[model samples]
Target: MDYLRVAGGRVLRPDGRVERADVAVDRDEGTIRAVGAPDEVDDAVGEPPGEALDADGSLVIPGLVNAHTHVAMTLLRGYADDKPLDPWLREDIWPAEAELTPDDIEAGAELGVLEMIRSGTTAFADMYFAMDRVADVVDRAGLRARLGHGVVTVAKEDADARADVEESLAVARELDGAADGRIRTAFMPHSLTTVGEEYLREGVAGAREAGVPVHLHANETTDEVDPIVDERGERPIAYAESLDALGADDFFAHGVHVDDSEVDRLAEAGTAVVHCPASNMKLASGMAPVQRLREAGVTVALGTDGAASNNDLDVFDEMRDAAMLGKLAADDAAAVPASAVVEMATAGGADALGLPGGRIEAGAAADLAVVDLDAPHLTPVHDPVSHLAYAAHGSDVRHTVCDGEVLMRDREVLTLDAAAVRERAANAASDLVERVESA
Candidate 1:
């Protein structure tokens, strides 16, 4: 019967309504038990059994979910930038990554998790390497995550490629349901272009047998799509479907170069696409057809990709970029409205990950973010939802709660030591650069 209450804030409800309310969480189960006006919730809960967070002058919204990321890439932030994806990976990122150790991965993950928590992200789906370290960081930081080791097989012998595939599957199986259910696992092939047909099919088959969903990069650029279409005689999505990779539980990252038919196929499969607008823009990758995907009944979520590409893991920035780019890409002023972008950052992401906590209501998981609207930039709050999409920044988040536990309060992260994490990651990055250069 442990309880924690968030009192006196404007709560964003499931249906996009905003009301002054108090949210009561059953700490034992980490679920919202009551949400109503302060006096009403007080009467319903008969006093918080443990603690209460004062949320006056704040807007309480569901914690944002980052649907796709490479969390440990925090070590590589600014290591390689202003280059396209292929050369950027081949020349800079891969060589540096080959020098990383498990400690390096943990340090980078800790830094990434610190960034996400401070920025009001409660959960994320990550496709990266050394995911056991990633899961450890997520659990320790009190955030929920779905993690998988990214598998790349191209330019390798069959034995080496098969070994990579096996390792990816092994990591997924070993890590699923770890960390008191705070961690989930997925099968992540780096990309359709990077993974050969036989390897992709085998990985997907093993994932299906293991009951894990698939996550990967697909159609990220015209370069990736043209070659696939030239060789397969169809779209990238068609090739993915041919290998039985399309499913309701599966989600893809960066479907930027997808065509209308590909969007239709994704919608038909009930699959989700995570839009990483900042990363795509920074890499000079083409804009994703977010409006078309949503119009086709596909669920679209927002992401920051990874710090190395986006240069920062900020979902608020992602929302703003998504709105601006969607309109320009579609050449319509109303292509992606503010509300749509807000939904993509919150509920859309949670839904895509098959987790709860996107909505503020009874029986929902108690994952929430508190934004200090008292700032001058947030003045004259014409519309809270509009503010979330068009005006807010990560620094405006004053508090973060996940699983009914207060992780950050008043701009201070409680579960993670931010200063220590930043120092460790800085040292790791410095050493990694030296090692790669020396080699």
Candidate 2:
């Protein structure tokens, strides 16, 4: 089998301390086989006979994982910056989205993937409409993703809502293992506000049958806070538990309104939560109980949410925001150590998504990111994890490889046509902007 060796970088292997090593990958099988000094590569495969990427003494980590996103919103970025979640969705985003065609969705998804690859994200969990197009774009970009067919019950309290859920469930089933097993599918009932108990139950049942994940937003705002409390006579987590939907594989995003009780449910149910710190702060959504969740043994990862809300799809920015906001929320400067946050952005994210990735180790898929440690922002690094979490920006990501395929190298993308993506994004945004402004 042809082998590729990456030499001269400091790699963070799963069970070892960060050390300089050469990593060899069996490209034909898409698995990493050898990771040691360059000399060991020759032993593993004669002459390491293939492409050799010189890491140049940079810091290499498992590719950054973005656990939750609505990628097609790239067309809606910066549309309604200062508005609350509900109003922003209704007044700006939803209306603009109403005008989107499949081509528009493809353009936006392509733009989002380009941004993600450039920023070092190897895999992400995405929930949006027109998901076939999302799948197509993500597949073409050579990125790993768990796609969620985001379905909202047409009428919150009607039986029709259950039917809508079933429709989405069917779609998820059809696409669950599509895209060469690199893309997975999930059930996504938009939110408690949009889909009622029946649809939620249907989604839970659907997920149980497919053995896949369920991605959804929960307790993101106080607008949802009181309604869930009044209707269910309990918090969102309690209501979710009543429906048997919370679990490790069922990743819930934006737990901003969840209280101690909900945190307890998450812990007991082994549910994972994705903290979209930048989106929460930008939308003025209350900070999530991240410290409480962590202490309660809940898996917490970081996410950029979407370009529309965060106005940027940068996971490096997400990591920094998560760390700062995590400390601020707990009223302790050390609430989340930089090292821990880096883990949350990397390994923790992979765990939340149930993906076999997020570390440089033998038997692991060759998914990784390389950073130019020689850069100005990374100079004289006191702690590699700290520098990665706090100082690095997405622009500093030098390379991104996913599933043994190089999506980007030296800040140049290899998978998707970035220039075409940019052009289509511009045209799509112009159309959406005109629709929203006129509305």
Task: Pick the TM-score winner.
Answer: 1
**lDDT tens digits, residues 1-439, model 2?**
7777777898876753688888887777777878888787668767645776668858888888999899999888877789889888887777788788888889989999999999989989998888889988877898888887787875345766766677668767877666677888788888877777777887888788878777789999999878888877888888887777886688899999888878888888888999999999988998987888999999998889989889888999998998899999999998887777788888889889887678888888888888888888788877777788899888887888887888897889998778888998999889867766776
Q: Model 2: which ten-residue window has the lowest total lDDT?
A: 154-163
Clashing pairs in 1: none
lDDT of 1 by residue, 1-439 (tens): 8898888899998888889998999988989999998788878888655888888989999999999999889999988889999999999998998999999999999999999999999999998888888888888899898889899998999999999999999998999988778788899999999999999999999999999999999999998999998988999999989989999989999999998999999999999999999999999999999999999999999989989999999999999999999999999989999989888988999988887778889999999999989989999998998899889999999999999989999899999888999999999999999999999
Worst 10 residues of 1 by lDDT: 40-49
TM of each candidate vs. truth: 0.99, 0.96
lDDT of each: 0.92, 0.84
